[model samples]
Target: MTIDSVRGAPEPELVQLLTPEGERVEHPDYPLDVTAEELRALYRDLVVVRRIDLEAVALTRQGELGIWASLLGQEAAQIGSGRALGEHDMVFPTYREHGVAWCRQVEPLNLLGLFRGVNHGGWDPAEHGFHLYTIVIGSQTLHATGYAMGMQRDGVLGTDRAGATIAYFGDGATSQGDVNEAFVFASVFNAPIVFFCQNNQWAISEPLERQTRIPLYKRAQGYGFPGVRVDGNDVLACLAVTRKALKDAREGQGPTLVEAFTYRMGAHTTTDDPTRYRLKAEEESWKLKDPIERVKAYLVRNQLADTSFLDEVDAEAKQVATALRKACLDLPDPRPLAMFEHVYAEPHPLMTEEQERFAAYLASFEEASA
Candidate 1:
């Protein structure tokens, strides 16, 4: 069914705890008790994350990396939801979740390895409770649902210390078959997972209009679960909504769908030219709603941080970016033979034959030179 078919007369209101003007607001059901230091820390996180993205983009342009999928405007959505997780919680991420990876403490160099073509994935899932970036669109949703089912079977739900799984996808992924099937499975089994869809208003060249005429969250109602739309640019709102969803899942309340409504301030990837499909006016409009700027404004307005503190964060962010560039440049290229090494857990006759053939081909070139 089309999104317009399922949508109500009016789109559901977004859950917002902070306005674009940096004003603090309150929600009746979702309350946040953040200290001044914590607020400052969150602002730091946003700044560093954006710096990381900027450096990566520059690297791509300079031919140091193959390509980059920038999380330029969606930093709040990723960092906010990422920080809400418990130590044992698991996350399945889309390719652009650099901010979330940072919150999970995954090394920055590891992320660069993927774009640098040095490795398929750079970090262990178990080590950081973060899955490898999934480039196949909505595939991670199914993986997350299956994982949550395993958690339920293991009696890991309905406890104070219980953990939940979060599946991260894009607005475009909601149209995929895998995502819909995941919704069905999670709903039927009541899996303790959160489907976090970062609806950044564009599915590559396609706008939100191309995906659905209705708000994405409303689709969850038909699947026997509750869904809420949150202001993805508002870090506090994202954190609050995600925290509540995780708590409910841990308590055996089943799955939740969180549609984070935000905008992608950059092209789909380094290879894309957004000037073709989108407008200059549109880009300028979103600049006013910038995620990082709002947090910086709030910190300054509330006297939670000063020029010295903000400057310190800026300095720290620069160091991180510099270090990332060095690490990326220092990474050694993988040997050609390395491709066949990790294809299977156990060796197979066909693989052995292929490896031998490849080795003989390499030796032939050496022999000819001799």
Candidate 2:
């Protein structure tokens, strides 16, 4: 994957295609080799992701969900890496990666339940090959590293079929100790894990400058792995770079550090206010790089779609939001006792006592005989 270096530098050019206005450009070395169908599929992925993001935010406003992390601008970074993943490739994601969960076929509503304070995790990670969204910053990186080491022990690396892991963390997480340690372990052991850092340029109120002085990709050099930046807003670039990284890892080429340079177009969460820390001019700047608009531009420029198609895509995005709204409002409240069903394989005395006490409390509320 590290084919050529930048002029007088050790790293290659940060690969990018598809300008903010939707012009399809090409990388000198990492030319996109996907078909038109694949390109359109990327567009579809972005549409649905944005729809889910909007809906989740609305649910939080309606008080149906406890919290929501909106990935409004980082759609391309998620979809590109997500679509590039094989079915068997395990994904370790930090919370707010709703787009990645969507790419893995996790039911959109499953996400709401977690935010609704109904359950610890809405979807089983094993079923989707996506670990439960880790709340602690950058902790999942170590989990991915350990798992990748296990994959090596299992002798799955270098096999064409399956054996790649991806750890999804935020720009802020890059500053965490575990993320750095993960890189160290992965490099020494030659673990087949892809460290995907989606640098959305904001950690709550702090800017990217607060997180790093140099481009994030440059950090990979100290760990002895290839690190490269990609235009995270460019869907094609995300897929091309991440796919190559995973492929190289699987082929025993070792780990990769992919820093997706992107922006957080929305607030950190429904509870935070960007206006307090960021400027309107800054938001306007990222708006020019809207992930959805670029794909729409591509469709129009390539004659793949017209006004009618654009209208249809809009309708679809709206329909998705409406459906999510209805579903979240009507979602059944989980049985109080259901929470105790999967806590442990072997019986835990403390869990059993808590379950019984909670069940009795629920029964008391069910009917008060007069």
Evaluate model 1: give its TM-score: 0.97
Candidate 2, which ten residues in sequence have the lowest lDDT sum? 1-10
Model 1 is weakest, by summed lDDT over 10 consecutive residues, at 1-10
The numbered model that scores best in lDDT is 1
Model 2, 260-296: lDDT tens per residue? 9889888899999999998999789888988878988
Q: List candidate 1 segments past 4 Å from native.
A: 1-8
TM-score of each: 0.97, 0.91
Q: Look at candidate 2 and tell me the lDDT of residue 14.
A: 65
Give the runs in model 2 whose Cα sits over 4 Å from its true position.
1-13, 356-370
